[model samples]
Target: MASLSLRQVIKRYRTGKTELQVIHGVNAEIADGEFVVIVGPSGCGKSTLLRMVAGLEEISGGEIAIGPRVVNQLEPAERDIAMVFQNYALYPHMSVFDNMAYGLKIAKVPKDEIRTRVDKAAKILELGHLLERKPRELSGGQRQRVAMGRAIVRQPQIFLFDEPLSNLDAKLRAQTRLEIQKLHRELGITSLFVTHDQVEAMTLAQRMIVMNAGHMEQFGTPEEVYNRPATTFVASFIGSPPMNLLHHAPGNRPGQILGIRPEHLDVASDGWPVQVETVELLGAERLVHARLGDEALIVRLHEGEGAPAVGSTLTVRPRQDRLHAFDATTGQRL
Candidate 1:
């Protein structure tokens, strides 16, 4: 396990006389054996940053260091990193054991050593019983595990996951997520997982990097980013259903955008008057979609709490300390 560092990393694409910069001077330091997730919406440069670190994409400026060595100019094989791609990248004709041992074979590792490493990885990934099956004979989750097993056997310094759960069903994704968490705990490998899903980011990350529009929005522990977002983009992007941003919201300073999460808004007697537009019952809780003048807001109501019917009027007040204020022009947190 080793620490990963990104210092003022930049990426650009040149088309004729024009240069389009995609990653803008991003900086982050990931501790050894920590699980760090890079999350954002599509086209936000999250994957680009990951590829850069994997030595697939060239950095336009600055440095990327894996452990003690700067890996910017090194080949992907020389980086001492293992990348598990989204597609599972397993060979259809190869057995699970062969798939896991392929890399070691390519590196000319001795046969007995490769067998020991593959057996250990198979045991770790719970693929020991299925080692004789080909990729076609295995289930999706099993194949994904085989992919992970291939990476695990290498015992690289860092593990890179590029949305490894995207192709699985909801239940499988959840189950595999737990498996990955357990794998991390048992192996204690340094990992950098890139995903656009906030749920994955919140659940899997010890710390996370939030990116938007070619720039890093915030980098912090999940608790810090969730409880106190550093920017409006972070506030809006990191949460489920996202934070509501209202211009000139009640009790907000002039020229500032008021931000509040649905769960933080409470039913109050003297609060912002809202006209209920829709209500969605989500088993344990209900989401109340309402209008406050021209702005739309969502309030989360727990079970046992009375829910407002559509076309009805109610008042929802944001908790004082839970409220977030951001600059109207720049969207930076205030």
Candidate 2:
């Protein structure tokens, strides 16, 4: 395992007349064996950053270090890192064992060592039973396991995953997430995963880097990002149903935007009057869709709490200490 560091990393592309910058002065330090997720919406440059670290893309400026050595000019193969791509990319004719062993073969590892490595990786990934089977014979999840098996056999210092689960169905994605967590615990390889899914970032990351418009919006534990978002973009992007950003809220000070989460707002006898528009009964909770004055808001209700009738007037109060205040103009937390 190896610690990874990026100092003021930048990526830019030349357009017809002007330069277009995609990643801007990003810096981060990932501890050895840590699982860090780089998350953002599509077109936010998360994949570009991951590519830079994997040495698949050239760095426009600054430095990238894997463990003790700087790797800015190193080729992808020389970086001692393994990348699992979105596509499984398994050779259809090759059996699982052959596909997993091909890299070592190309590197001229001894035949016995190749067998030992392939068998061990297959066992770890639960692909032992499918060793002789071709990629065409395996299920999507099984084929994905084969792709991972190829990476595990490399025994690289770092593991880079570029939205590896995006191809799986919802159920498979959830199952594979558990598999990945288990793999990390057992092997303890340093990993960087890139995704646009906030739930994946929240559940899988030891720490998360939230990105927007190529800028590093926030980098911290999931709890920190969810509970005390650093900016309005982070606040709005990290949560389901998102936090409410009110410009004309009762408690909002002049030139400040009031922020509150759905769960932090409760039905109160005397509070902000909200006219109910709709209600959605989620399995374990409920989402109340209402309008506070003219602005729409959503409130989360726990199980057994009755939802108010549509078109009815209801009062909701925010937990004072839980409220977030941001600069209205800059959207920075205040």
Candidate 3:
């Protein structure tokens, strides 16, 4: 495995005289064996950036290097990277064993070596019993594992995953995530995973890159990104209920916005009065949607706490230390 580096990476699409720039100057230094995830909204250029690193898309400006070599002009095959696509590109006629062994076969590896590598990868992915099965006979999760096993047999310097869990059911997605974590632990390959799901990003990433409209918003561990978001876009995008940004929050200074998480606010008798608009019960916790002046905010109540009635006025207090402040004009954290 080798470290990956992106130095002022840029991408642009040209049609006649019209030019559209999609990726800005993105720079990152991903250490060897680190599982870094690129996450953002659908059109945020997360995939574009990943594609650039994979040598699938050409970089319009700047440089990309894997280990010590600059791979700006290298083909995908020459980049020493294996990609696991979302669709699980597999040969219908090939069995699990053949599918995993195809790459080694094409490279003219000896028959015994190919078998050994395929068997090793199958064992790692728990596919030893399914070696003779075809892609059509396997479950969706199984097929994805086959795809991963194929990448494993090649033992590339890096692994690139393009939303490999998007096609699975919720339960299967959760199970596959655990399998991937285990696989990473065993193989320890440098991986770059791209996805639009925040939960996947939070669970699978060692360090995550938060992208927004072609810009690299933030790059850090999940805890750092969730606790101390660098920008308002990150603060609003990373969480489930999302952080509340109050432009006209009580006691806020001019040109500043107050930010607080739903779980950081508590129901109190002497604080900001808000009228309950709606309440949602989610298993172990309750979400109270309320209107404070003209602004809307959500407050989370844990189990054992009584849910406030709708249309009732209640005061909620924000934890002083948990509060966040941002610039109104720039939408940047202060």
Clashing pairs in 3: none
Two-way lDDT contest, 2 vs 3, winner: 3
lDDT per residue (tens digit) for residues 42-150 in model 2: 9999999999999988999999999999999999999999999999999999999999999999999999999999999888889989999999999889989899999
Which candidate has the top score in lDDT? 3
Model 1 per-residue lDDT tens digits across residues 1-334: 8999999999999999999999999999999999999999999999999999999999999999999999999999999999999999998999999999999999999999999999998998888899999999999999999999999999999999999999999999999999999999999999999999999999999999999989999999999999889888999888877898899687778889999999999999988999999999999999999998899998999999898989999998889888888998889989
Model 3 C-alpha lDDT per residue in residues 1-334, reported as the tens digit of each score: 9999999999999999999999999999999999999999999999999999999899999999999999999999999999999999999999999999998999899999999999999999999999999999999999999999999999999999999999999999999999999999999999999999999999999999999999999999999999999999999999999999999889999999999999999888788999999999999999999999999999999999999999999799999999999999998889
Q: Model 3: residues >4 Å from true position, as ranges?
A: none
User: Each candidate: what lDDT?
Assistant: 0.94, 0.94, 0.96
Please report, as a residue range, the 10-residue window in candidate 2 with the lowest summed lDDT: 244-253
Q: Once model 2 is optimally superposed onto the true structure by TM-score, how far is the C-alpha of residue 164 displaced, in angstroms?
A: 0.4
Clashes of 3: 0
Structural similarity to truth (TM-score) of each candidate: 0.98, 0.98, 0.99
Model 2 CA lDDT for position 201: 90
Q: Report the error of model 2 at residue 63, Å.
A: 0.7
lDDT of predicted model 3:
0.96
Q: What TM-score does prediction 2 earn? A: 0.98
Q: List the residue pairs that clash in candidate 1.
A: none
